[model samples]
Target: MSPARVGRVIRRCVALLLVLGLAGCGDAAAAQTGTVTVFAAASLTESFTTLGRQFEEAHPGNRVVFNFGGSSALATQINEGAPADVFAAAAPANMATVTGAAAPVTFVRNQLVIAVTDGNPKRVTGLAGLTAPGLKVALCAESVPCGAAAATALAAAGVSLTPVTLEQDVKAALAKVRFGEVDAALVYRTDAEASAADVDGIEFPESAKAINDYPIVLLKDAANPGGGQMFIDYVLSADGVRVLTEAGFQAP
Candidate 1:
């Protein structure tokens, strides 16, 4: 082979190697961008979404994904080997279901309230009013935190009002009233406030007996442990507290 032709072939091979190395570096950088998955209670929808945006803004390359539903169901999913970086439950009982979580921190507290459609068409004054003939009411199923709280509150008030429908989560119960499917529903105060445009929260005295503590923790099998811890820390931060207060959640 001629010397000039051999030299040209060597140059082409070196250039190809350099390009492949740069491509591998780009792939590695892309892999470093983390995605943190958070499983939270349905009542945290508004507050957590706002916090998620703030978290993304604070950490440029990290993304926050949320799975909002009943706390009990979320815990069950986590225990069943669902991939989750963080777990924020509406009640301790649900959080207890998941083993090997970092020490849970109470972030906020919530209480049940009677959620009625705007203008209170039924003029429902209190729990007793829910018992009025033909007044359709929606309640969370007993399996959920909100439902358990509602049951405790009702029992404390010595009021047993049968609901027309049993929802799986507070959001679902609140939606029933928001959509005019039911005259009223029992949901967290934060949930009612989040949907204030479509529903009105009626604070009842019995709610004091059923306040729920919201606990957040990093999961043992977290894919993005650093991001999860950052998010939990953010929730306990001053700005996060401000957001929770704005959403009508009481400080823990």
Candidate 2:
């Protein structure tokens, strides 16, 4: 073969190899990026949404999809084979219900409060105030973490009152107060604070008796376990704490 022809063949081989190497790198990068599906408590909606945005910004090509609801309902969904990458529960009891998850870690704490319409139209003052005659109230169902906390706080205060409706999640209960469907609702301080523009969060001493510890874990069958771990790490980081505290969640 001519020397010029041999040099041309060498250049073609080098270019082909470079193209193959770049293609392989692209495939690997694609494999490392996907949506991390997180099943978190309803109370975490606002803060988690904020954190999800930050996470996606920091890790280009990755996304966070959240399924927010009552912790018990979330646990049931995960235990029944729901496809989720992470589980963030409002209480450890709910977290314990899921079987296929890594060891759970308590990330934050939340307390219940009396949520009333803005300006306190009902003149609601404390847990006791919720029992006034002709008052309509809303509480979470007993199975929900917020409801369990409400029961404990009401018991601590020695107050007993029937709610007009029992909501399945903290946000639902808070919505009752926001929409004027009820006079007040016992809900997480974070939830009440998030809707402060439409509702008033009234703190009571009994809340100290029923603080709920929030726990998070990576699901064993997670489609994006690495991304789930990344999110968990971010939640435990200083930035995550700042967001949670700003939303009225206490440090774990």
User: Scored by Cα lDDT, where does model 1 land?
Assistant: 0.93
Question: How do the residues 1-252 of candidate 2 rate in per-residue lDDT, one tens digit apiece?
Answer: 999999999999999999999999988855677899999999999999999999888788899999999999999999899999999999999999999778999999999889999999889999999889999999999999999999999999999999899999999999888888999999988998899899999999999999999999999999988889988998998999999999999998
lDDT of 1 by residue, 159-183 (tens): 9998999999999999999999999
User: How far off is residue 81 in model 2, in Å?
Assistant: 0.6
The alpha-carbon RMSD values of the candidates against the true structure, listed in the order shown, are 8.7, 6.1
Q: What lDDT would each prediction earn against the true structure? A: 0.93, 0.93
The estimated TM-scores of all candidates read: 0.87, 0.88
Cα shift from native, residue 169, model 1 (Å): 0.6
Structure candidate 2, residue pairs in collision = none
Q: Where in model 1 is the C-alpha error above 4 Å? A: 1-33
